[model samples]
Target: MQNTIFITGASTGLGKAAAKLFQSKGWQVIATMRNPEKENELNKLENVVVLPLDVSDSVQIDQIVKNVTNKYSVDVVLNNAGYGLIGALEALTDEQISRQLQTNLMGVIRISKAFTPHFREKRKGLFLNITSTFGLIGFPTCSVYSATKFAVDGFSESLASELAQFGIEVKVIAPGGMQTDFAVRSMEVGSHEAYEKLTAEVSKGYSPEKLANYTKVEDVAKIVYEAATDNKKQLRYVAGSDAIALYDERLKLGAEAQVANIKSMFTF
Candidate 1:
């Protein structure tokens, strides 16, 4: 029997790319999106099942897990459904903060909890989490976005330890800027004049040939697929040149020094 993989936020970007690659590799792909009605491409793929899933909704997540468990034996669960919250913390409304934490951090936890029972019962499975380079370092206008990823970083690390006893693995994929609509579509900006210069500086970092440190969706998909199927007991898998640069710097400079270097760039 083919191994079944359940992926969240498969409508576009990394999720969409992973779905295509996994299906191509002969895995049963459960490509889930918030609005499956708007998706046309993935549905056309052979051996790919497009389902509706908004990770923030616990009820919907539970229902989907119940429905899936009976039909396909899911071997991996990819928590890739999240958006970017950019801008100064001062400018973020209560709702914006709540949404960011709920979707990026809480949502990942919710879906993982929903599947824990099944994974434990089988005593085997992989929880592949899609975090970001922002999770490891701080950016000027991406405070909240980075916080969400940082939380996932810790959560995945701890979850890996806890689930290992049950023959399950928790892995986090933290990549740098990818060639996606992340800056445009998946990003929500809360602007403030005090942070305008920093925001502009940060925007320039995403350019193809410069500080933006862009990555390809296909490359990320490959990494995720490998992490899911490699059967290795590794906890963290990182991708992209920019992300590597930051990771190396953090190793050499230590967290405080690295953060100070970033803050030195800003006037505030």
Candidate 2:
């Protein structure tokens, strides 16, 4: 039987790309998104199944987990359903902050739990969590987004250690900015005229193309595949030019110095 990969947020961007890539590599794909009605391309592919999933909805998650586990075998679960909340800290509302954590952090936790029983029973499984460079290095504008991703990083690290004996491998994929709806459709911008200039400056630094940034959806998918298949017992797989540089620099200079170095590059 072919290995199956269950992916979240597969309607577009890295999720969509991974669904297509894995299918080409002979893996059955359970491509899930918030709105399957919006998906057309993924459904056309053979051995690909598109399902509706909103990570923030726990009931739906429970149902999907039950259905998929009973019907088909899943070798890997890619938690790639998340969006960025951009703009000034003052612009962020309490509800927005809660939703950000709920969707990005809580969602991952709940879904992983739903799949844990199955993986534990089999004594083997893989979890590829999609984090970001911001998760590693703190920046100016992405306070909440960074918090959620950073939480994922810590969660993956601890979970990998905890589940090491269970024959389950939990890893993180931290891709820098990529060319996708992530910057537009997947992100929500806050409004605060006072921070408009600051947001613009911060936004410029995040652009995947500008200043030789790192944000290619295809490249991200390739890295995602590598993280899923690689057997080196690696923990974190980072993609993109700028994101790689950030990861490297963090290793060289410590946290404080790394943040300072990044801020020095952008104009205030």
Which regions of candidate 1 are displaced past 4 Å?
207-213
Q: Which window of ten consecutive residues has the lowest lDDT sum in model 2?
A: 205-214
**Tens digit of lDDT per residue, candidate 2, span 148-263?**
99999999999999888999999999988787756778888787988787777778755655634446688889999988887869999988987888788889888889878867
In angstroms, how far off is 52's CA in candidate 1? 0.8
Measured with C-alpha atoms, the lDDT of residue 26 in candidate 1 is 96
Question: What TM-score do all the candidates reach, one by one?
Answer: 0.96, 0.95
**Model 1 worst lDDT window (10 residues):** 205-214
Give per-candidate clash totals.
3, 4
